[model samples]
Target: MSDMSEAPKLDDALGSLPGSRNFRLLADIPVRMSVEVGSTSLKLAEVMDLAEGSIVELDRQSDELLDIMVNGTLIAKGEVVTVNNRYGIRIVEVATAEARMAGVERRG
Candidate 1:
């Protein structure tokens, strides 16, 4: 078996692995996390006609869970929640490791 303790250094803005495969090596490093409510694509003319009170329709239904993304990758699905007036997410489902890797591979 290959010793991950001497794992090759992966260079990127995300941070280096310090020649080890220990998961804790990355536990403290922060990442950009975001919740995607929905998405829509509009033509240039439609976008130019925006007003003060414009309503843009999205592709997902209201009842559907929102996508939870980290570093531009979809990692989970969750619903909205509120705690002490602050909005948060109630995670409903998490993507399998293979699926998450697939997303990362596609972007890479």
Candidate 2:
């Protein structure tokens, strides 16, 4: 790891580069991700009553889209789907840049 003082500053690194305004550099930027959606709770009785094939219902409705998150930020909304017998989520709508950036800044 390098100390902040020893590392190139953001302005020095990007400002001095050629084609700095191109967005290609950011196309594949990697980031940590996490997600959260509506939740529900079960009592001790319910917990104990659960069986091997039991299903606990979530707070969200079947038609509702789940939130897709990146680095704990809401980036998009997606509906659950099935592809090749595997479960997946298809993004239905994307959050705005301002919203995503606000979330990232808030966490930082």
Per TM-score, the best of the predicted structures is 1
* lDDT tens digits, residue span 9-103, model 2: 66567766788666447746888754455778989999999999998888988777788898789999987768779977677899999999998
lDDT of 1 by residue, 5-73 (tens): 575545442355454456557657899999999999999999999999999999999999999999888
Candidate 2 lDDT score at position 80: 73
Q: What is the C-alpha RMSD of each candidate to the true structure, in Å?
A: 9.7, 11.0
Best by lDDT: 1
Cα displacement (Å) at residue 87, model 1: 1.0
Q: Please list the residue runs of candidate 2 whose C-alpha ends up more than 4 Å from where it truly belongs after superposition.
A: 1-29, 33-37, 41-57
lDDT of 2: 0.79
Candidate models: Cα lDDT each:
0.84, 0.79
